[model samples]
Target chain A: MITLNDLTQISETEWEIPQSFRSDMRGPVRIFATRELLDHVLTDKSLEQAVNATTLPGLVGAVTVMPDMHQGYGFPIGGVAATEFPQGVISPGAIGYDINCGVRLLGSQIDFETAKPHLDILATRLNQYCPSGVGKDGMVKVSIPELDQVLRDGTKWALKNGYATKADLARTEEGGAFKGADPRKVSERAKKRGKSQIGSLGAGNHFVEVDLVQDVFDEEAASIMGLKKGHLAVQIHTGSRGLGHQVCTDYVREFQSAVRRYDIQLPDRELVCAPMDSPEGAAYLGAMRSAANFAFVNRQLLAHAARRAFEETFAGKTKNWHLHQVYDITHNMGKIEVHEIQGERIKVCVHRKGATRAFGPGAPGLPPEYQKIGQPVLVPGSMGTSSWVLVGTEDSMMRSFGSSCHGAGRMMSRSKAKKKFHGDMLRLELGDRGIHIRAGSMKGLAEEAPDAYKDVNAVVETVSQAGIARKVARLKPLAVIKG
Target chain B: MPFEEISHTADWSIRVWADDLRGLLAESAQGMWMLTGTEQAEGPRVSREISLEAYDAESLLVVFLEELLYLSEFEKIVFDGFSDLVIEGEKISGIMEGSALRSMEKEIKAVTFHNLAIHESERGLEVEIVFDV
Candidate 1:
């Protein structure tokens, strides 16, 4: 286990665990957190997991973790690692089970004050319109062949099916589709699990929230993205569902032998990997991209559902009720990109698990409207708390591989949270504060209580102070829908 | 031996123990179901056979639990109990029986191999499994 004393503090918001600490590590681990947040991280194995991540062969630069870091299986949540392309290894565990699991923000012209009267019904409609909960099916079912198209085309399928708009695609990461996603590389079992899950929200921390843009810090940037203070916006937090989970499971299982075949040594079995140039690596990349594409459509369909809910609640009453795409970002993903590492520019596969890509201004692939600002980073807080909108900085591009914090990292266990807070009481508490809540399972609600997570404000502060991300706006929840 | 839910910062974890490797695997499966607050529906009992091969005991444990997880995910069926579990040289076969999952309070996303190791203790065999929920 790693302790704070072993870390060399670079700044109030940054710390480092040198490669010398572990002889097997190929690189050092850079952490973005204040002493207060680092104290919380030390209580768990988040730092140790980050150190384990450093051992990935061909690791370029330092393995950086966001302030929301929390122990999660092999690689800690909010961790980011970049490995040399086509040579370094890609570990499925490093990318996470929920491939392309991410957040989507939709800005609206409807002001919250004017929409307050319709809040309760909007929450109910969102829950009803968006299929959710365990064993829930999507709004539309596709045949196996059609599911392949969904995987191959991603948001293109959504656009063709009339579920998305051109602007939605333009504003999405990679334009809402990952190229080279060959469905043949995906497993039949993963396909079966994904076929029925498209457009559906599976349980466990996934939710749809209605928020009021409470404050805008960077007005020029916020205005360009169509975000205005006091206006209502929607946040959808979900991922590729069972298909992605199965893909990771299948690869993790298969890679067990691949590690032996490659003669690689690992501290944990979950981090099993193969050289990116190997057949196994090529297959996983193809299949992982397929899963990622599926997740893009998953969120797009949910966004379509949210739009419907918005229309039903505000159309007849207000003329300015339509919602526009702000941005969509995938937090749990591995993408091949070129970044500067110690004054050297080279290509690397950046693995971001519970970390969002926060590309700074002038970065390639961003929509024209955002070229002057930066890629919008959506950070959702625990239910009934504040969420944030941040943008990547040039410093982030240099120091953190263009990644930032994902959310309020969990500080307590679900079992402990459940034992400490009652779901029914939580509902009343949020209700007393004027936030409407609709949840499939009350027991599950207790497990995600606000107290279970660290202070999101503190997390945002650390990233902002560290020059990794800059705050644009803060949002307060008015209603939430959870599976 | 027995199984118990343990504290994991962000996900579900269970520490399972038994008299042997096979018992440990069975208990881990049961313990996972318990953690999800899963309830089986009243229906004709369903039985399924599972056969898996891995490189070691740890991999075997992951595959066994993953098979069960896949069933629950793909078919909405939870194999509450296992019988005739035989483990031999990284090859395990067993019979799982349960009813349709009526409802599940929480859904476990995936079974992870993080720090997963099956160990022999003076009392018996033990393992700690972390789950991505």
Candidate 2:
């Protein structure tokens, strides 16, 4: 087994395992972390996994691991890579099981000071309105064709069903739909899994929380996002659910053979991939995009459900509680983006696992209002901690493929956390802090306790220090809804 | 051996290993099939080429198994194992042959890292992997 002594420190924040260290590696593996974070990463095979990601076919740049990197199935969580378009392989493992597992932030009209009185009631209503937990079904029942449309159209389908509006779509990432998603590429089983999960939140680390925009770092950027100090917002984190999981599982195998057929060599099986131009690769992309679209619809419908919850909670209030979409970004996804690699503009399939797309201001893909401040990067912390609102930087576009850290990466395992903390104690602790939590299961709550994860402040500081992303605001949780 | 009545979730995982890269890969596939309850369908084998590359050995295992799942879903292939395991760096190239996946076939939806472990133990080499089916 490789030991910690094998690594050579490049910078205070970067660690490198050179290509000479392993003959199977196509390129070098670079990790961004402090010495303390590196100690935790070394406890598992995460560093080894990052090295394995370097073996992907036609990898153009060095494999990168973000500060929040953790051990995952194939590639380490928070890993990023770019492969040659059409020639580089796309492994489902690289994108992860949850296809578009992402975060969405909504800026509300009311301030936290005004909403504080109803915080407890709103948390309960949100948990009740949004279906969650294992084997949960969406509030909307869909037929086969309608479900296919949902898979194909994403948030646009929500607009058709009167679940969303044009403004909502405009505020979403990629306008709430990714192009080139063909539902025909999706399987029957995948379809079935997605049918009932369109507007539902699946269990295991998924959450919807009420947050207060506690601080703002950039007045101009914050103004564009309609953010003010003490204002309330909603952050929802989830993904494509079983449909995306099945899609990834189905494609990793297809590319396994394709990699051999193409005669490429690598160090890890989990990093298996086929050339992007190959039939197998194209099929996986099509299916992945479909899954991504499904996730977009899933989140949109969930927002619709959240709106309904508010409507029910305050039926005869002064004004309807509308949660306007601020931004939506998928952490686990591969997007075809053009970036300057060594001063040449090249198209690359940027695979971000447990990372967010932090396209800088004036980037082509962002919405009109956000063009000047860059894409709003929603980084949700562990329950009862502070999250962040970051904007992409030109430095990110030039240096790290317009990517930034996702959240307060896990430091402790679920079992370890469960053994150390009790659900009752955690509930009381959060309650003592005036943070109301409505969780489906107390056992689940204990697993996601704040201590189970690293500090969000440190994680954000790393990215800001790296200059890939700039902090815009810090959001503190008032209430949390865990599935 | 082909699996039978195997049921594993992303939450509950197992890791198996062998000396050669191919042997390790075949056993991993075998373990996964067993977890998915696919042992009951002892059908004719179909030859298919499977290849993958990772920066390390563990990630290679993950990609290899994911490929097995993909082939089973699309091509109806339920591979028992790989024969010629040749691994260099993170890339593992091998020949896999398995039965086709039918309606009655057990399917493993996804691979997870809930309780995953990989190491060289008394039983040659062993790995602990989780499946989310």
Candidate 3:
């Protein structure tokens, strides 16, 4: 078990576990956290997993973990690692089962006061329109052929099908579609699972919250992103659903032999991987990109549903009730990019599981309007708490592989949360605080109580102080819809 | 039940033990059902045959449980009984019997191989499985 005593404090918000700390580690582990947050992380296996991640072949620099880090199956949540492109291994577990699990923010022009009277109706309508919960099919059903198109075209398919607009695509990552997506690489079982779940918010910590932009930290950046103080915004958090889960499962299982064939040894079986140049790796990359595209389209469809809900609640009453696309960013993903490491420009595949890409100003691939400010990094807080909007900094690109924390990571187990808090009572509490709640299951709601997670403000402060990301605005939840 | 839930900071984990591989597999399935709080409908019981191949016992166990999860999520079927089970070099075949799933309180995203090992214990065989939810 790793403890605080084993770490070397690099700074007030930085620590390191030297490679020599463990014989199997190929590199050091750099952690970004405050002293108090480090105490929370030491209680779990998160640091151990970070050290284990250093064993991967072709690793560049140290494995960096965010302050919100928590113990996960293989790679700890809020972890980031980069491997040499086309040569380094790509572990399915590193990218996570929910491929491209991310957050989408849509800013509205309507003020919170104008939309106040209809908040309850808006929450119900959003819940009614957006399909959520376990084993629930989406509102949009596509044929197998259409599903393949979604895998290939992503939000472009949504555009063709009237589910999205050009502006929406421009604000999404990779234009809401990743290149090199091959449907043939996806299993038939995965295709079947994805065919009916195009626009669903699956269970387990996924939600769509209606937030009010309460504070703007950077007026220029917030203005560029169309975020106005006192206005309403919507955040949709989900992923590739069952399809992505099946894809990861199939690849993780197949890679069990790939590891043996390649003669690669790992401390854990879940960390199994294959060289990016190998046939198995190529297949997984293609299939994983396809799943990611499915997720992009999934969020687009949900945004469309959310727009309808907004229109239903404030269309005739308010002149401009439209929810414009602010930004869509994926937390769980593997992207090939070039970065300078030790004064050498190297191309590497960055694997981020529960970490957000925080590209700095003037970075390529960002929309023109955002290039001056930087990419929008959405950090959604737990239910009925404050969510943050941040921007990437040049320091992020040089120090942390252009990555930052994802959310207020879980501080307590689900069972513990359920045992400590009553679902019904928690709902009432939120209601008394004027935050409307619509949940499919009270037990599920209890599992995600705000007290179960770390403080979002503290997480944002850590990342900002570490110079990986800069704060733009803070949002307060007015209503929530959980699966 | 020979399996019980264990404390995990995030996700779910369960420890199971039995006298043999077959018993271990059956009990693991039961434990998974318990973790999800799966309830069956008041209908006629259904039975189906299942066959799987893997690189090892750990992989076989994951495949077996994943098969059940797939069925439960996509087909709304839950299996609680196993019979005529056989395990060969890298394959397993058995009959699974259960009823339609009426409701499930939780969703198990995937069965992970995080430190998964089936080994001999003083009692018999034992393993701990972590699930991603």
- Considering every candidate listed, which one attains the maximal lDDT? 3
Cα RMSD for predicted model 1 = 1.1
For model 3, give the interface RMSD: 0.7
Q: What's model 3's overall lDDT?
A: 0.94
Query: In candidate 2, what are the lDDT values of residues A201-288, reduced to their tens digit?
Result: 8777888888999999998898888777877888889999878987876676555566778887755655668887877778888889
Each prediction's whole-model lDDT (CA): 0.93, 0.78, 0.94
* Candidate 1 residue lDDT tens string, A270-361: 89899999999999999999999999999999999999999989998888888899999999999999999878899999999999999999
Candidates sorted by lDDT, best first: 3, 1, 2
lDDT of 1 at A416: 93
lDDT by residue for model 3 (A282-386), tens: 999999999999999999989999999999899899999999999999999999999999999999999999999999999999999999999999999999899
Model 1's TM-score against the true structure: 0.98
Instruction: Summarize candidate 3's per-residue lDDT along B1-133 as a digit string, tens digits.
Output: 7988888888999999999988898999999999888999989988889889999999999999999998898778898888677888768887879899999999998999999999999869999999999
Q: What fnat does each of the candidate structures reach?
A: 0.97, 0.11, 0.85
How do all models score by TM-score?
0.98, 0.82, 0.99
TM-score of chain A of 1: 0.99
RMSD per model, one decimal: 1.1, 7.8, 0.7
